[model samples]
Target: MPSLWHSIPALLLLPASISAVTLDCKHIRVDKQSFDLSALGGPKTVHQLQYLQPSISNTTFTIDICQSLKRTKGVPKSDECAGGTRVCGIERIYNQADDSSTTERVIPIAGEFSTSHGRAMDPEVTRLKDSASNSDSELEGLRVELHGGKWPETSGGSLQKAIIEFQCARDVTGNEGFEDAAEGSMLDIKSYGNLTRRAGEDAQEDDDNDDDEDGPPELPDLDKGKSLQFVSYKPDSDGVGVLRLNWKTKYACEGAYDEPPSGGGSNKTAHWGFFTWFLIVTFMLAATYIIFGSWLNYNRYGARGWDLVPHGDAIRDIPYVVKEWTGGVVDKLKGSGGSRGGYSAV
Candidate 1:
């Protein structure tokens, strides 16, 4: 009974350690369905063309973050984030619903920015402290790049078009789901302040360029949270950082192959099949002629083995013709052998 009494205090302390933290934030969505390589009206297949099903990995999310004029400790400041209330840090909070719980430190703003096309213009979705992504899973980087967004020491976008690559196993492989690298495939992103407008006429269409020398372009970063302009940064008003991601996926819908058979190979096979038969017939005809000639010689002329068919009459007549030309009828009557012994009296 005394030991059971000691456990009462320990059970009561559990609730105090794990407190429920409700995050006051907004969600900015960067949808993927809008940016499709095929819909852009160009040569769709490139970079070896390995597509995936229209599932989770096919899409990416981005959010622009802005910092307020009021300085938040550890949050960096930038020219684009000047004079307004903006987002300071991006914190990924975890609650007690899964196997484990973790609250990652807020991703600090780097003050770097890149310009890209935008579509949505929901003020309610943008002006909050929280953000949503294309994926709920945590991914390290882009599959095509084998890595994710980078925080370089400059502010600009790569002029080269980015590629969105799909990741799926071979047809023979049993694994069908994209959940393995799903975490590393997702984009945990932040960007400049909220978007003020939807995609406009000035928005540039996705560039279409498959380099003749180099390979295809890379997929744009989903978490490339570009800083935004702000009127002022106060207690509530913060600068915005916009996230823009470009992902291209390649996948088969139903019956397809990695390397479809080409006409060149097919054409070669067709021609080769015909010529092989032609050669066989030619060889057979030649053999038949030689065999028949030997048979005729053996049966009609009693020729020995390996002897050519008789055509000796033509050779014997040649000398007769020559003798007749030189000695007239006297030599011609005895054929080519006439008077050959000793200039015979005849």
Candidate 2:
């Protein structure tokens, strides 16, 4: 017989519910505040965002939040993201001698889609607090981190990560408006690269250790005017490459937190309390015991009427027993005493 541990992998291979993905923006709760971004995930559509880098390999990062991205038309499904992918990064490498690009690398940064052979980590969601906001009591922004993306062993051992921040910008309409308003700060992406080299000596050394030309990039802090842009992509010492992006939208504003739907109250999910569950279980157990016992009595001894019920005598006497006990208590309270201080009869 195979060892029990050997079967563990088979057990893990069992079909798992698709909802295991880390973040579900539809019912997100942070610090007692709830948010619903289900609207952003259009029907059979994903909210797509793209970032381009022309210098090092015509690299493009196409991403979607809250929904999987669809493959491009005329492109083989294998060339793009697999089904259920939320973040996909493509790098087209051009030949140095000829201006034509001959090679392409597909990097699945983050996604919920998985296969029997492998599964990606569910997206991680966190809160980003903005001290400047007046609603300091609630979260001012949201941070979503995706994991389970790994570079080939030949490329590097680091797992790819994507961290997207949604900041509150009440004046902005949505991602589209934010993207348009962010054109001025596009140059910051290159400045951040220089900053990365100066940030730490180890990062420079690590870059040389790996042949990947497009080493992990980094993002600068949110600029004064930019509403949407790349943040950073720095590989950690522990072999994790993180790509960060920021998007400002009114939907992330404080007013958006747990706002009731128009023309209706919030539909809070009702749950039974501990006592309620306990009573239900107790009743079920009692009913089961009584039904089983009655069936046994009927079949085994031909019992009828009250005799068919187990402990029927004790149950029938319960009312009388309570009455007698109540009467005794009342008599005791009245006191078996004679007139004045005379002794009471035994």
Candidate 3:
């Protein structure tokens, strides 16, 4: 007879073979741009800008803005931008004349790009709106134009880079409440390409379709007296299925299918059995400790010991000397038995 441990190798091999599915991936990247609005006669306000990708559903992109410096103890630092809570659309003029001198805002730029499919494929672009919105909040939008081109073929090589450009306006309100505007150019670009050939492609291509039907009719024999039978099935040289044999073996081994077998009752039962035994063992140990402690305590102080000294009858009849030394001595001692042994005055 074989031990249950003998089946572990087969069990391990099954999952490894089943988990070997291949996947395809696409790569994308975005670059950061900086813009200064102070050139428009407004307080030199700095804007943190990011271009956003479009959503799969929507083809529009968006720009988010926020105060760059947060006010700390009323002191403005060079690196700090204006801090406030408000998310206005990109069209809304940021940096209006407020009480504060130093100001900053976060802005997003969004538009669409075309994909290789000749159909529009918009990537999601995300940005942070102005400060009044949560400091960590991000504004998301889609590209304005659909990505043009077929999914770039990766057979030759990975995509190198793609570029796009647009125009942006920076409008600032001065201390006198006069607004000034400056137009600057915005450029957005991304690069793609890093492709590998799919695995198992050659094997799939070489399968013999004509001989598939004329091949042996594979069937399991019920007449085979079952001790523990191991079935070994292997994919053909072309990565196809071929039944080898059902042999009498000490361990019955099977491999994992593309999908896992659904009967999980045994696993649940084993978990419950483990928990039940754990609780039983825990309670038994606790009870054993409690009983052992009670037994030890009873054996210690609860057991009586023998008296070492014996009292004679004559000694018992005689009056105690401590009793005779009473009155004056007792009074001087304040009736505390004069610190004598045995007799105590109450």
Highest TM-score against the true fold, candidate: 2
* Model 3 lDDT tens row, 1-346: 1332254355445434433211100111122322221212211121122111110010111111112122335543332222221111111111112311122322111111222112222332222232245632332211111111111123432221111111121121112111223211111111100000111222234344434533222222322332212233234364322221211211111111111224553334334445865886676565455344434544664522111112223345456655666555768777464566766678
Error of 2 at 143 (Å): 1.2
| TM-score, cand. 3 | 0.15
Model 3, position 99, has a per-residue lDDT of: 14
- Could you tell me the lDDT of residue 240 within candidate 3? 28
In model 1, where do residues sit more than 4 Å from their true spots? 1-266, 309-346
**Per-structure clash totals for the candidates:** 58, 5, 51
**Candidate 3: C-alpha lDDT:** 0.25
**By lDDT: ranked, best first:** 2, 1, 3
lDDT of each: 0.28, 0.58, 0.25
> Residue-wise lDDT of candidate 1 within 17-100, one digit each (tens)?
323111111111222111111111211111111111110112212122222224434645542222221222222322212312
Q: Where does candidate 1 have its weakest 10-residue lDDT segment?
A: 192-201
